[model samples]
Target: MIDIIQPPKAKQVLKTLSMHDDDRHDDYFWLNDKENQEVIDYLNSENDYYDAVTSKYKAFENTLFEEMKARIKEDDESVPYKFNGYWYIVKYKKGKDYPIYFRKKDTLENPDELLFDCNVMAEGHDYFKLAGLSVSPDNTMIAFGIDTVGRRNYTLQIKSLITDEIFFDAIESTTGSATWANDNKTIFYTVKDEKTLRSDKVFKHKLGSSTSADTLVFHEEDDTFGVAIYKSKSKKYLIIACYSTLTNEYYTLNADTPDGEFSVFQERVRGLEYSISHYDDQFYIVTNADGAVNFKLMKTPENTTKFNNWTEVIPHREEVLIEDVEIFKDFLVISERSNGLNHIRIKRWDGTEDYYLPFDNETYTAYTATNVEFDTKTLRYGYNSMTTPSSSIDFNMVTKQKTILKEQEVLDSNFNKDNYVSERVWAISTDGTKVPISMVYRKGIKKDGTNPVLLYAYGSYGHTIDPSFSSIRLSLLDRGFVYAIAHVRGGEYLGRMWYEGGKLLQKKNTFTDFIACSKFLIAQNYTSPDHLYALGGSAGGLLVGAVINEAPELYNGVIAAVPFVDVLTTMLDDSIPLTTGEYDEWGNPNDMTYYEYMKSYSPYDNVKKQDYPHILITTGLHDSQVQYWEPAKWVAKLRTYKTDNNNLLLKTNMKAGHGGASGRFEALREDAEEYAFLLNLENITT
Candidate 1:
């Protein structure tokens, strides 16, 4: 057995926070000063302690990493996607960490044109990401965004595809995407606020012009709103979209008119959420207007885009949630979710034929993928389940023929889909709501209550955690572990109502639902409290933190990755990134009712002296969405308040941001460390 090393104790400088007649004392608030030398020292000390405790199993961690990495086909390439007049493909050479963007003109037999080799571009940077590779309509110029610090603030740059020379025009602090006007020389991009990193302004830039001369096209004056620029799929209009949590407004300009003023599509109405897509002469809208809780599809003439002028194309159904729509010259494809499974429905423009794609899996994810060409009858879609490898398919709407473009290849010779089983089970919450749990395990594993089960969940932001295949997860399944995902509230797993029940005043439902699922697993003999583990990241990290605070005895170990646990404090500070925009999801604490409610369940504020499960927490120093300090302060408080001798470790990625390490192999190492932590607790160190 590895000896537990003494953890670092952060010095507590008493800081008092007051709101709505409530007073809370924070001791580790001093750790929030990222620029302070003492703060850096404390974080480093914690990391050092984590290394010391886990050093005994370092070899095992590397072994787990190699085991996971061996399953990947290293020299992999994404399925070719055709856009404009070129067929574009992203490929990675053997042993390379980054992708090489390639293209072919006219036909697949043509010689490949090298667009960008990211490995060469990322030579000197510790962290690198390429985003928004937009090719001009004329196909000679390309605009892309690059981020080296992982804070998500990308620098926009343009390159001449023919000359292979990068232009002198470089714009900084952008959201990393540029929407080109039909003129090809003019582009519109969004810039973020310096401190908060909120995308608030849209600027128009012309080729060969200094950024100082760029015109501010629009500014989102509301702090709660963010703005982004994009061209419609039809490529007829450039759009500037302004959105808050509950409201959306869009401005459109004809693609040919680069200097023309943009007209608002529809006036913003509170609680009304909508998205727009362009067809031939009309605009297709998917919205939750007129009390359509599940949302419906509507169409309005492009010249007159207003709510009153919109006509219903697809009526809303209570059981079905219209997630997205793809426009084609001859057909319209709608992505929908019913119960907890995704369905793709195809409809011809003349309304002569309409049908849904068949899926046999009880729990799987299917969605539209890279359908950039609007004139084709073939629809590109992706499919995968808990046990099935992902496959990209092209389905013909005319003949109902399907072609598999490429399927994920698990390089392990011993891996087989038949060796594993996946199913969906419902767990009844305290409020009588039936929550779904998607689980997968080895076929021979018995429900003997001795199995180690990892319950994972991300119950926030209306983002559903669908059951998808992961080659790395074979390490656990092959070792007799049952992996499960609790479809809790705060996510749109069951529908919009499920998310509504888990946010704002009802946020506690997200935590309780996860706890209920854990208990249900225990009662079913799939796992016991001694063998059950929990895992979540970001908002999901908030879920596990709140869960352990409510019922720590139920879990043997917990892994919180980049957790947003400092709720009350973060919500009260609007200057923090994403806090103002998140008021609708998590109520603004400036209000008295929200202040009291948030204080009641805030993970850091509610830490008490009690025996807790072994915990491993991770954070990235440059994380912009959830600042590094939130997790740092959380770990400090957990160490101070918890009375258990169980392992409590904090591992911070000093150079990376919220997404963690940049290289594919480096990411596997982090995952291996996490799995090692859990396995070490079970004493499975082999």
Candidate 2:
């Protein structure tokens, strides 16, 4: 049995190491003078090739981008809500540093009325980029988070939607999640002390408050983490989710006061699962605690706490993957995956009468429910997929009437959903763990087993990277390439057990599972090794780096996006953001056991002088999630140690963070570059 330890505990020994110690292995990449120069030489060569290939399409791509921008009434526009006889919509424009834009829904098409070039909210420091936007119920205030780069700490800022006047000082913390109270006067967010990663305190920021010094109403000091807080629709209770990393213990707290320290009202149906929604005062959580890919929907009475209160509303089905759950009035809309196809169903509270809704003409790979609102006569909702853009319509419960309000990007003549086919398949892992793999390809492709395939995966930190649509992927699939997502361990695939089986020392199972999927594809005659490519970003990028190091010959090309390559270095640094907090997820690396384990797989340190695959290492200059310097240093060292002169391309986003480009066109352009790179590698002409 492998004893996997997370790296946050490595502080003591690493702190003792002198910065001047030349023999110290604190730096992820340590190369001699000759090796350093050799790596630089290799980088220069790859850069030449990358530049030459990108140059041909630069002008054409720019022209296509400008043309695409011209068709949009605004760079990007959210659905407008009619309030106080005025149509209000959140508009985002290209080239604007700030996320906010002012636009009236009625004068949407008029260029003069649209505020595109200017920032609705004045620009702040680089660290204060908008994290989220929540308009008040009355449309008077806009609540948003301004997070500092590198540091996970943030200040929740509330601006008057009417006057655009800012109110209150920023709320700072190491918490990644936050929410506004329905009253709009108070903002509820989780804050962790820099010293301990496991302990968390919930703070309520009242509008116009100057400091968080006096605003902390509740603090959980033990080894408990709190997140995913939201107010009940009736405003009578506050629902907070608290979980322990040592044991998969989760509980729901129902507090009368939004920020009050409350007792655990209901224990979460433990093991591991995602709580999707809480509607009609009943919880709708997805959990595979029972086993397999099938999940159970357990709903307890409001304010009740007990296993007896946990009633199985929807029993698990083996073949179907319940992707999402949406509550609209008296009905619950369940989005699911069956036989690689996406479907939706409406179920009543009694579960007796359920209607299978038609989800015809799905061009994208994945979709999500946008919103649900009661319109007196009917309930209105919206849904969108990767290639399909977004569509909105209203459904009437009384009359069984369905009316389409608007379809996103449908008017664009250049929009083409026919370029891609989204698919879901299962591959067994080393332990015979059934992994879900989602694939995308152009419509009408022969199973000639010659098409290039890009397999993607991310398995760590209890995060689930679900399958969804991507418009940009069409650029690759339009050629003869197949893009697939491998749902491996460290993710919530079959719920908590699946994640447990893959986390800690068992983390290697994630990489092997990905490798297994790749082999499975080749064995099934879907694609060959010569044409297979693998890609992953961030933690997913960690997956890519590990796989390439472990089985480089298995792939023709590899793309590692914003990867955490310097795992050992990060876990040792106290100043580094989220390092201390992530101790629960990754063990302390300073200990001999953890240090040895991390050294075994740390990509930057593990770069050996051996034959390697064509690799693309892309990262952002301003990425806060995985530091830009990580990939920068890793590529520098890998180029030196790798025996072959295979293309090891490094493309760093100069202005973006982990998510890459903020603008729609800029993002698509980056995607186009990525797809273009993959297509060139596969010899697939678009």
Candidate 3:
């Protein structure tokens, strides 16, 4: 007789949650106690059960991991960009999991100056992330943030570039960024609330001083808003920006006067959203003022930085969304999206020349990259597509000449862009809206409803998942899997209106659009339900979760990573990280209307006595964004409510956070595990 591996059973304690005259009985609520030994044991058991179930395919998983890792150029280095008379470069040594930072002074021919070797600093830590590398104006010191536990709360530290010695100053619970003032000794950074992890305070710290002596420059008292400090591109002012989902306010201070009070550039307005970029004597603003849904470009003199003084520079277009603008000494480059495609438009400051850079690909991502030098005509940009590798290019605005600085190198010798085919297809949603789907597969794929397809979508927060190159995804395409990205309504793919149509009361449009895409694929003979799979992570994970609950039969299997399954409960609790701040995104559940609507589709609450597709859920215990308990409780509830005995597994990474793994190669292992789960569902073990 064959032995069957049994899954772990979580013991549930009944807990009643009451909100707005509504009561909910939560059986697995006890799992939310992070310090509870029972909770830890239950989580460990789930991990053990996942290991036992996948032990048979360990070799295949390793093979997949190696195959994906082999495609990465081990000793890869990023394109160097010049800043403060030095060229900065980030490179990884072969077999190392972390990056090494280097710099060349004056010229590229100069000997490389070793800044930081993350491999050495990451030693003894299972999870490590270094962020916010800010060099002092004098180029004698550097401020950076480090996180060892992967919770995103970093410790800000300063180091002497001249002496190669780390300073004694250290500030904890920061957002992992520090902006330096012109006076190299002073710096400004944002600090997060310990409980909610919200960036609520901005502090000014002076070098050679204790953190306790630091001054609080600004406090974002509104629970719905967060604050951040950044230096203007012109390097003349330090700005503190307070922002919420639909509102924004900014305070500015001359960088030379580190101790001076910051003056408010604009007062807060409930529906006003704007960002500032400093030029010679004016501030360029990208805003949705005057009901500009897609946003418009406006400018105000530095001396008169107020709404009344703002004048339009670029009018808002119904079909286009102004994503960002980069200011140069002689030009302005605007990043816009129109009809789900990226457009880079360069305009001369004197209004003499205005035109857009041309792109031929039907489905590709292109955007302006780091252009630290304000005096240059060269615009550095990045471009990639589903079938093409990513390339960093520099285009001279004056000469109309472009140069490819560096292209992503795929280590596999057999890899070729022509071997794959990518195309855009439209799916008619239930609401009669046409949603776009970008799909890539092997060139010889046949639309006979027999091939395997992985449909993915992240329909939340107006975050568009563009069609971009991914060498790692080649493992799936090469294995005869068709990967498709459903540009649903919740994202800003079409325009700001597309995102508006899928959020709050209309959030169901996101799920329906994804379902429409899957059905369209099946109807078009690309893949049938038996060979279709669903995949999403975080908000995207929530997408797949709700998807399976509404139409489980549409997908043969599903993968949800760090899913926000318990939506209603999470939104109701302001104490949860990102809860209060995201009230604008996911409506405040305190209101009865939002509460009822949220409960209607929340993945955990909707799980009932019905058949479900084979599912593999993954989460990180240290995930601050979407708590591990969300997924843990979700899996427990599904096991009890789901009628089918399809594979239902949960794997928790105890060492990492929202992002699964910190190391480049280690992250591939997580991807391999996920891909293995999907491939095994198709009986494609190798």
Candidate 4:
């Protein structure tokens, strides 16, 4: 294995940058056979080291299972009506072919008992479900989404929990997640039209009726993005969040009836980015619209015509970002994050008092209220982390008491979190942009700054990869290696302006920004050229492929999972599923301007005749977003043109879609395999 962070390479990097004057010219051909041979030998050497690391932690899985089993056994509350709980977390257990211990209740351990599970949506079709739950107010009718073959083009289906009968179904171009109206009969959801860029229309479907009974409530002519609607508790004011791709616009709407016309109630809350909550006939919104990282709440009267009712309930918060807001009785429960830690806060309606809930060490990325009635006096909420299985806890807001209610057994006891550590660092980009990077590494590794680093970035599609828990990450982080996520352009970290600045003709900004991040890592003595690996999936995979093509010498290996490598071809192919809707983001390739820009950075079009990093390109066989043949054909063409064959491998998921795997354990195994590949490429722990 090569000791990559030697003092001589830093000077070499400086000399290379100073001597290179042609910025327009591509710099992908620096890799030769000598460099390629060295990388391959290092990978072979690292395999034994990774095996030893795996052997040391094999016993940890058993410990994880025991703890989870104990947690599950302690909770004894069970009800005849299993639908009375907060989360109906139906999942495939390791020992069971059918989803077992799915309901939040104790008695209903098997999903086979649920009458609804017996009904298939279509003939010869298995209803593929994702993360969705029923409204707390009425669990009688469950509003769920079903996607055929995991295309992501879902159909919202309302099933009677009692009778197991399909009440209604509405087809959507994208995700079919919907919110139940106060009456529980109407489901409101947004849909994207295949034709126009900004033709997303919000519709309401009346249950117990045909699809023709559905009515369009709101429509957008401009490619402005609008979703995440929160129906007011009063059922009169419905806040539909509307923001343009290039600008942020917040609106509140007045609904005269359950399925009435929606008129703009409040417009342009300058600093609020559409985070609003309604409690006690009032509106509480968290907005950075005020130029602060934290958020402030705005209160508006129930009446849509009165603009004067719009007032700040909570002034600009300090030191924390309000991650989520929920109405718990007379006060508001806000989940906040500051310096990587999460806290649950309770604020009074009068805005004069505040309190904190006991969630000091509890891990929950998302939390919402459900009408789950448990015998416990406290309010029970669900919480989980990457390593920690999903568990429900009864937390008392008044007394500040918490009790564990239930724990979902998803993984074995061998999963270890102590072996991993997540750290945050800021990298200065080429254009003087400060990029936030998250690194996860093995616990025993010294910051003595010499370790293989796997860098990942997306930097497109206005997607903000929030700091969330992932159990699959343990496979890599426990192996004496480092994993980092680069927050680059086309992401919403700095808001709409940041995303717009990195997209379209400025698409090169994504590539440059990512390169700058990798350079910063090396310059700061975090890692070295030979020990650096880059990994990304989906659009992020596109970023991974482009960076490797632009700077093959920078990384030891590259992993592009379900990547959009054939950008120019996919953008031009109108027959593709999401091609038309994505024109607003990537621009129409038919246009000469977009054609020129895309050709410059599109990975599939830019294969070079030089030694390259060990590339592992992964794609789902049935992926609707990114075609599988894109990676397969790109790798084939790349191998033919490449001077040095540096392990150009493609792993296609035959059983899964874009998400890789349907089951939890299968997903973890795939993640483990990818991480193992990265470790092997970087010669980590060898």
Candidate 5:
């Protein structure tokens, strides 16, 4: 047993890791032995201590959870989307933590046929997730994937839609996604390496086939690459793609030809990246080939998809990064980013009507949504901002008309967009990069430095964290807190150049960019350092860990959820799930250059005997992406060196994985806990 504030001091077991002529000592390495009883005991002790520390907020946490949950329509049903011969729908009942998947034929007036009730399946499991729901083309059977252990090793299962019998077919150790061939009986899925958990193989199975008899369709030999299985949008080809952070290679086989051998559409080339979409007799390729760093759209005859055959359809733009494209029978929907804002452009096949979708907010996210039908004149999309609820929309391409299918209903009647103000601002970084910041707050909040502000950023993996509405975020606004998102580098927010500037050797740009944003916010009187806070999850967690290490006096507190703080060790170990494939992302530590560069900012390795801001570190016991030990080891090491008496806490979810809790309502509880941690630090209690 240990005191609430004095966490159980982890017994240090010195372990040396040598690479690229360098040796590093990791004292908390013993925490990595998860199978040992002593290790489990240590984790349990920490959880108990965290529970004890947060016990006083039990009532507040519950209230916050219930308040957020109340904003959700418990009996909500998703708008039906037509596919094949049925209209698919997903609904959640009151008091249920899972969804019931259903479908109806011909009309919404017909009785719904229950496909799967996740609530029942999730019973008795501490963690459960259902995904890869693919109905056969013939609509006779369904293939789905489920994971209960939270490790993301989904078990693929099939059920007879006609006989209503759950088949004995099960494929284990998959990535939780399946693609069906046009034959409806043949299904393909990706499998991960048992040790690294890299999706390295693609397997195909026939209907009612035994798991032992599944055929291995493809195996990716490169440890730096992971594989994925998917069907072309046109439903004509089964696609197998192998990719690393820097490269992409794809192979295709006709969907109707189950036994046919796959042929490469484009051979692998270093620094070349392309994505394929089939339409008519041609394959539209979005590629960064020929030094088009911003990416360009190219079309080639389906029979010859090589580089030489590619003809430019949409030339690359220096300022705009083409993110994605959704193709229809008569239209091409382009998703792009420019000046740190997302825009959706609609261009007709004949190039007669080309225009951008109009949006009012300065910092909102608008992108292509579900568009299953290819022969339609209407386009479906999603739009949301910090002050607006997410909306599902249908835009008529011919008439230029707009119709809102549904806007997420926030049950809180007191919530109003008019009461909030959102805008885009910029922060000049040390290198003169004008970092964009999307901020929101209660309209009447003073621009005086007295306001409390929570600045969030995730600058990694070229994944942009767009500005969107969150019903839960309302609690922070109502409590007089300002929320802002730092559009820093390592993300493709401004363009491809933004991401290139923040990865590999330039990775420090991400941390500095975030720090610059914080300084700008304070200088502008949005909030002073005394009332500032930082928040990020996963890689963003890594961002907070790094930034606070470099600029400890910039914040009052930080909440890092499932953070990847132990960078050097995690990235150097090929046995870790994401290590090998992240070489291009973080750079291969096998090289001395990258090794030394990563050690410069590796949070755990750089922890010094200095004062640190208040930190709340969280992880899940079964996290597959960033293992739980990374954070556990980080917190233990931080406790050993930090001189400050600031509230340092660690909370680990015993049942969840990378994404935390699987249940919808259950996840809200964790959010409430995080919000409560921030609120309590500021002495704000309603």
Candidate 6:
């Protein structure tokens, strides 16, 4: 390893942020100015130091990268799903960095017709992402959104399938989707505010017309809410959904009448959340109405689309949380979670039969997959766990027979699910809450405190971190490492109550819960603080940052990827992405109570002059979600305050965004680098 004579110093400019009559000094606030040459130089210097520090482990990183890459099948394709007389497929060719989309008509024997080649679109761009690939109702034209810069401001364009012509008519700064009206010419899309980056406006555009000629269909005036447009599965109505963290409201437009105005299916009510799906004569509402904290199902007449006219289809259940619903002609598949594991309950539309699809593992993720056809008896779903490869299965709803359509093939022949063991364990928190942790390790690995363990979690926005299989994780498992996921409170792992208990005023519970899980593992001899490490991304990255401030002694090292560390400052500035819309999750800092509460645990605000664990902080210059400046500023602050001579590194992906690298193989290189860091720190060398 290269010896650093002296760590580079970041020039500090004293800047104090004021909130609730209190002042907090942010010495590194100037780092947020991305245009400054000094700021860019600092980031580049940090990146150079990171590379130099890890130079000795480059061979290990390469081996790790190659092994992980080898595990993945060179040429992989997704299970083709039938839509509108054509079977659509997304496949990756060997050595290609992008997916190629194709469609075949009527049967598998038909030749695949090329639709879009992302490889061609992604050329000459540092970052590229294609989203919302939608074919027109007539299947004559296609509308897709592409983001070349990583800010998520996509430029939408239309393609003529018959003429093989790409139109230059571009709609900029969209939410990366376009919902086509039944007429196949009128398209509705949502646009983000330039400053706030909130999707607040919906507009309608007719083909062959200029974007300036498009009409603004609707505008969500509420700063806390955002809007999106999509067509119902039934293809009868174009739905406009405006939502915030706590509530949702939907408006419907008759697809047949392109010129007609949309009417509200339900008016917006605070704390009232619902999503709609259409059947023959009624609209099904999956909602948390009438004190159904865990959510329930209801139905209303097509014409009388008010909450008052709704009738219960599946009433509230105290133990179950309805995560999603899939409607079919003969079945209503309810994707739910109970005991922190997913369960798909299939019920006949007539209410005659009801049963859950069987899942073998103690902790595995299973959810309803694409079932666009309203006439099918077969229900498609996906299943996987820490040890199981993902499998797509089609189950005969009537016969109760499951046929595996495709299972992910791990190219490495040495890989075997039978060689690994997974367990669902519980950890007791300081508040006596039972936190579930799913852990997996290679067979014959002893559960002793001497072994290394990587605890991962994302405990915010009610996003559950389900136990899913990863081919890349095999490298860790095979090297005497145990992988565990903490089902902490902020996630809806247990139910809505669990999420409620960990957010807003109770947000500290998330950090404490993670710490508690770590202590429990140590107390149980699963791992010790000396060998324990933590990993989280984005808000979860915030979780790692906050917990380390509170209990730095409990971890040997931790990785924070694209973290939102400067919470108080970020939340106070509504111009940042996700700030205005996230008031409900992390209460608006303008309010004194929220300001004080957030100030109490804000990671960057709480950085103290004390020893901390070895840390690896990463970010992207073009990250649209958590700005790269947050982590950059955080590392700068830590350098000034921390007393530790222990390792501290910062990696900035100049070409990537929130999600690091976009390519299939390029992403593995990042995973390899992370693993190399962990392994090198553990003194594992070959």
Which candidate achieves the best lDDT against the true structure? 3
- How high is each candidate's TM-score? 0.99, 0.76, 0.99, 0.71, 0.98, 0.99
Q: Which pairs of residues collide in model 1?
A: none
| Residue-level lDDT tens digits of model 3 in 1-686 | 12188788898789999988888999999999889998889999999999998998899999999999888889889999999899999999999999999999999999999999999999999999999999999889988999998899999888999999988767889998999999788989999999999999999888888888899989999999999999998998999999998899999999999999999999999989999999999999999999999999999999999999999999999999999999999999999999999999999999999999999977899989999898898999999999999999999999999999999999998899999999999999998999999999999888899999999999888899999999989888988999999999889999999999999999999999999999999999999999999999999998999999999999899999999999998998889899999989989988899999999999999998999998999999999999999999999999899888798999999999999899989999999999999898888998
Q: lDDT of each prediction vs. the true structure?
A: 0.93, 0.62, 0.94, 0.60, 0.90, 0.91
Worst 10 residues of 6 by lDDT: 1-10
lDDT: worst 10-residue window of model 5: 1-10
Candidate 1: list runs displaced more than 4 Å. 1-4
Alpha-carbon shift of residue 645 in model 5 (angstroms): 0.9
Residue 255 CA displacement from its true place in model 2, Å = 8.5
Ranking by lDDT: 3, 1, 6, 5, 2, 4
Candidate 5 TM-score, C-alpha based: 0.98
- The superposed Cα distance between candidate 3 and the true structure at residue 23, in angstroms, equals 1.3
Tens-place lDDT per residue, model 2, 529-648, is: 788899898888888888888988888888888898888777777555456546556666656666667667778767778878888788765565677668866776675677775666
Residue 121's lDDT within candidate 3 is: 95
lDDT tens digits by residue: candidate 4, 518-556: 987888777888888888888998888888888988888
| Clash count list over all predictions | 0, 16, 1, 11, 0, 0
Q: What is the lDDT of candidate 6?
A: 0.91
Off by over 4 Å in 6: 1-5
Which consecutive 10 residues in model 3 have the weakest lDDT in total? 1-10
Model 4 TM-score is: 0.71
